[model samples]
Target: MHIGKAIRMERIFNRDTERAIIVPLDHGTTVGPIAGLIDMRETLSHIAEGGANAVLMHKGLVPCGHRRSGPDIGLIVHLSASTTLSPFPNAKTLTGTVEDAIKLGADAVSVHVNIGDETERDMLRDLGRTASRAADWGMPVLAMVYARGPKIKDEYDPAVVAHCARVGMELGADVVKVPYTGDPETFARVTEGVCVPVVIAGGPKLDSVAGLLTMVRDSLAAGGRGLSIGRNIFQAARPYQLVRALRGIVHEGWSVEQALEGLEG
Candidate 1:
């Protein structure tokens, strides 16, 4: 690893735990200022207070979310995007570059690629190009890859998810994020097959906090590096407490039961 990339990786992944609790705050670009995201500074403050390792957002949001006064946190600039209003919403296009992230003082750069989507080839190309550029600058690349197309009956299938993760590694991502397969056994397969650190993506919001906690715990048990969750952490009734509880699990090795107990306390 390049010295610069290694240094940035430490910023995103806790030096002691070698894991991360990343909150993606770039949704405003895709879904239009949704709840929990309307106030970037406040939300970022809460996340930082809760001890999250890093936060991912688009280039435009850097000014708003990266505040002057707060506990420092890592910044990952997302390089790909497609609005929900677009006719081909699943087709993520490169809207920024690794150079853009460097100019913005980002610790890392991320790209989203939806496999099996009609524009999968283009997204893969973008990811490959971004990874190459990031390497030149010694910046880490986080790849959010998912199976979300007509042939995909289930995005969470262990086989499909593993394939998505492998694609990210093959293309040169330092970290890969994918939807968690329902259980640890299945999810382990996804993690075991990949060389890069694997993190779980928080898909849709769930009804029960315990359910979410359990999923996080299970992923950890299955050898996941950590989480790159957004809505579940940011949209929670208490985002700060939720992230603190997650830290206990991700960094402190708290079980789901222990995490829930801490969350309620």
Candidate 2:
């Protein structure tokens, strides 16, 4: 890795451990307005004040007043995107390049790849080429590897999840974001198989704060580094409180009830 890229990766890991929070605002490109994110600026501030270490957003959102306004939280530029209006939502096209990300002063770059879809081959090729370029440039690549296809029975399948993570590492991703397998023991296998750090993805919005916390606690206990929560934090009644609670669980290893009390009180 280049000196710059190595430093950037170290910075990302340090931020998450030091703060243990990531507020992902990249959902606008994939799911459109869900909730909480209706006003991006307010949501960003809430997360930042709540002690999030990084914010993942697209190129446009970053410069449009959402970039570093306060203490410099790490910025991760999302390079792949597939809007909801697209005919093939799983076919994530490369909207930006690592060179562009570097020019934009991004701390890291992320890509989305659907493992079992028909466009899987093309996406893998893109990942390989991009990974090579990123390595040359010393840019850290976060691969969001999801298993979705005709053969996929359960999105939470341990074997499939492990496969997705392994594929991302093999393609040269610095970190892999994958779904939780509902059990710590099973998810541990997936994390152990991957060469790089693996963070669990916060899937669709949950019904309750406890439910969200449970997942975070389980994933972390199972050997996962942390989380890339989106809707759970943003859509919560109190975004800052939810982020703080999550940080307690991730970095401090606090129980769900204890974390909730800390945030609520």
Candidate 3:
């Protein structure tokens, strides 16, 4: 790896733990200014204070969320986007480029590829193209791969999730994010198949923090590397407190019970 890419990776992935806790703030482009995202600067300050490794967002929003005083966090510019209002919502289009991310002072760039979606071919092509460009510039590419198609049965199936993770590796992603398979045993298979780091997406906001922490515990036990959670972290009653709880789990190996203590405190 080039020194440039290594330095960038150090910014995004913790230098000590070598794992990342990333919060995606790019939802506005898809779902329209949801809660916890209304005040970009405030939200970003809280995330940085909570010790998150990085925050992912669109290129345009970078300046809006920049922090002047809080603890520093890495910036990852999302390269693809697709609005929920679109007729083909799953069909993500490249909205930014490696050069764009670089110019924006991004530490890394990410791409979304719905593996089994109807537009799988196009998404795959996009991933490959982005990876090639990132390599040329020595930028790290994180791939958010999911199995979402009309023919898919269970998206949570370990076999299917593993396949999605592998696709990201095969196409040159430095890190891949996928939905957890619900248990440590089943989810273990997911990390086994992929050479690159695997991070779990916080699917939907769980009813309780304990439920969410338990999921994080299981994924870590199964060899997963941190999380790329959005709603569950930022939408919580206390977003910074929630991130501290998550940091305890991701970096400290705390039990679910132990992690939930911060929420109570």
Q: What is the TM-score of each candidate against the true structure?
A: 0.98, 0.94, 0.98
| Model 3 steric clash pairs | none
Candidate 2 global CA lDDT score: 0.83
Q: In model 1, which regions exceed 4 Å deviation?
A: none
Model 3 lDDT tens row, 1-265: 8888899999988788888899999999999999999999999988889889999999999999877786889999999999999999999999999999999999999999987788999999999999999999999999999999997899999899999999999999999999999999999999999888899999877888888888888898899988999998889889988899899988887777887787789
The number of clashing residue pairs in each candidate reads 0, 0, 0
For candidate 2, the per-residue lDDT at 21 reads 56
Instruction: State the lDDT of candidate 2 residue by residue for 55-154, as single tens digits.
Output: 7888988765364475566778988889778888889888899988898888889989999888999899888988999988889898999999888999
**Worst ten-residue run, lDDT, model 3?**
254-263
Indicate whether candidate 1 or candidate 2 has the larger lDDT. Answer: 1
Residues 1-265 of candidate 1: C-alpha lDDT, one tens digit per residue: 8999999999999999899999999889999989998888999999999999999999999998878897999999999999999999999999998889999999999999999998999999999999998999999999999999989999999999999999999999999999999999999999999999999999998989999888888999999999999998899999999999999999998988898999999
Each model's lDDT = 0.94, 0.83, 0.92
- For residue 229, give model 2's deviation from the true position in Å: 1.1
Candidate 2 colliding pairs: none
Cα error of candidate 3 at position 112, Å: 0.5
